[model samples]
Target: MTNDVIIRRTIEWMEGHLHEEVTAEDIAAQAGFSKFHFHRLFQSAVGMSFTEYLRLRRLTNAALALIHTDERIIDIAMHYCFDSQEVFTRAFKKVYGFPPGQYRRQMMSLMKMKEEKQMEETLKGWFLSGSHPFNYEMGADVETVHQGKQSGYLKSKTVTPAEGEFATMMQQFKADRYRGKRMKLSAFLKTEDVQHMASLWMRVDSASEEVLQFDNMSDRPIQSTSNWNHYTIVLDIPENSAVISFGMILSGSGCIWADSVTFEEVDEKTPTTNLQTEIVMLDEPVNLAFEES
Candidate 1:
């Protein structure tokens, strides 16, 4: 199997066993790799070590429990396999910058305020636009998230959207820092009842508004319902590129949640998903003669 597939399967396994005791040695054995080798591979594929990923995921879930449930903090911590309340508290405070009690109180207040405002609010650094943007509601979803306290979401407001109608939640910024580099955009996405399609998209545009590179995952669109899954788009930013724009687009009816979005520069050895690079052109006209066939 390809390394990507192996890593993905390993992550799925890890997610399923998050509540149980797991070790790198055990996971490596299951994957048919030495512990050391698997550690390196997992880090390269996931952008973090296995132990760190596990800790963060556990802490994220614990945070959710703190927000959504009235369970004792110690119980929530123990349920996630942390050794003790003290250990969990220290780790949680280190990441969240607040103790469990304070974090829960603050998050609960924020969530209550968010629900009161709901669709009337706009996500900072993002805007809604598409063929029929009014037919959709885009905002932060605190209840359904893949990681962290909340995720950004877009959902259809009407059951009978006009044919060919669509909407996108997008952001654009100066591409000066990424120019002349291969940049990767990664995000976890979940979908429900996506009738047409949904995709994570990115584009690099030149100063004249010409497309420099772009990919919308058209060849592998997300349709129907799906659990959270990691997706990425890689593209080379031309030196003349002036803006980088990206977001999730939902076509037709459905809802999609996006979380943990990130961008990082990658080595040239990493293949780009830029759709513009997929087209083939000849340096000069060839095979003009019928005999060439």
Candidate 2:
């Protein structure tokens, strides 16, 4: 199997066994890799060591419990495998910048105010559009995020969506600054129950809306489910390009969270992920007659 598949499966296993005590050595054994090799591979694939990822994920879940449940802080800490309440408090405070009690109170107040507003607020600087946008809900999920305070999400509202139905949370802007440059778009994404597919897409268009370059990661779609992983697409912005558009797309039923989106210029050594291929036109229609075959 590919390294990515192995890491994803290891993350799934780690999540399932969070309530129990498991060390890097045990996990490495489970994955059939040596301790030192697994440590390096995990760090490279995830951008963090296995222990750190586990701690942060556990803290994230604990924070959620603090917000959504009345569970005692100590119990929540213990449930997530923290040794004691003191240790949990220190770790939680280090990441969240507040003790559990204060964090819970502040988040609860903010959540209550949000609920009172009773309206679906569109994510700023982004819009939703697709084949069946009404079948999906798009929003900023502050509670469940890959990093920082929030992450943008697109989730299927209807389980029985029609075939080929999809939705996208996208944005477009003038491409004047990026013209004639190789640009790379990267984001951290997590998926759940993605029945069909999810992808990060980008397109460079001309003044009249002709696609000059495009890639939707169709060759490498995220399906079923996956833990937070970084994905990237690179394309050259042609001189005639007028607009640059990009977003995350979800087809069929599923949920996807996107965070830490970034765009930067890359050197010529970096290959473009553009899926558009050159088209050759024939001089004339050669198969007009049925007997030609």
Candidate 3:
């Protein structure tokens, strides 16, 4: 299997059995890899060690439970496999900058203020659309931001199991100024329980809306829960390219936050990550006079 597919399977296994005792051996076995090799491969592709990812994911869940559920602190700790409330609290505070109790109260206070406003808030200069808009929810979240005062959150509904459909928070603008230049689109992404994957996608189109270049991070996906990190998509804008449209998309069931999006022009030294090739340069033609070689 491809590394991305293997990592996706491993992540799915980990998410399914989070409450049980797990080791690198177990996860490596799940992905059909040797223990030693899988450790490096997972870290290289996912940008974090398996154990670290698991710990952070469990702690994230615990934090959310503290805010949303009526579970006690010790119970939450035990449920997430922490040895004790003290250990959990230390880890939680290190990541979230607050103890569980204090974090919950702070989150709730922030949420209360958000609840006082309309449930669906636009993301200002961005728009939302997808195959199943009704199956998704979009909003600006202040309590769970990676930078600035808020970030855009996209949530998928549990009832819709359509893997082909996606929810996207997008923005589009004229690309006349960026024509004939290479563009890099990047953003910070944080995800929770991503079943299929989440991606930073960019597309360049003609005046008629025909796509000229595109990359959706499909070759390398964020298939599991992860801490905040940067992801990017780079594509060259042809002289005829008219519109530049980009977005963060969530597939299957999960939640993702997009923060600090940036678009900039780059020189030819930077390679484009566009999946669709505009030209194929071959050493020579393969067929002549319809004769077999």
Best model number under TM-score: 1
Quality of model 3 by C-alpha lDDT: 0.81
Q: How much RMSD separates candidate 2 from the native structure?
A: 4.0
Clashes in model 3: which pairs? Answer: none
Q: Which stretches of candidate 3 lie over 4 Å from their true place?
A: 116-125, 129-137, 140-167, 172-200, 205-210, 215-244, 248-293
Give the Å error, residue 259, model 3: 9.4
Candidate 3, 8-38: lDDT as tens digits: 6677677777677888788889989898898
lDDT of 2 at 239: 98
Model 2, 93-199: lDDT tens digits are: 99999999999999999888875221146477788889998889888887677665778999999987899999999999999999999998888789999999999
**Candidate 1 per-residue C-alpha lDDT over 1-293 given as tens digits, one digit per residue, 9 for 90 to 100:** 96766776677677777799998788887667998998998887667887787788889889988999999999999999999999999999999999999999999897777544544465788888889999998998777877777899999999978889999989999999888999999887889999999999999999999999999999979999876766888899999999999999999999999999998999998888888854688799887785785
Instruction: Give candidate 2's whole-model lDDT.
Output: 0.87
Instruction: Give the poorly placed runs of model 2, Cα more than 4 Å off.
Output: 1-10, 24-50, 116-122, 192-195, 224-230, 264-271, 280-293
On the 0 to 100 scale, the lDDT of residue 229 in model 3 is: 64
Against the reference, the lDDT scores of all candidates come to: 0.87, 0.87, 0.81
Which residue pairs come into collision in candidate 1?
none
Model 2 TM-score (2 dp): 0.77
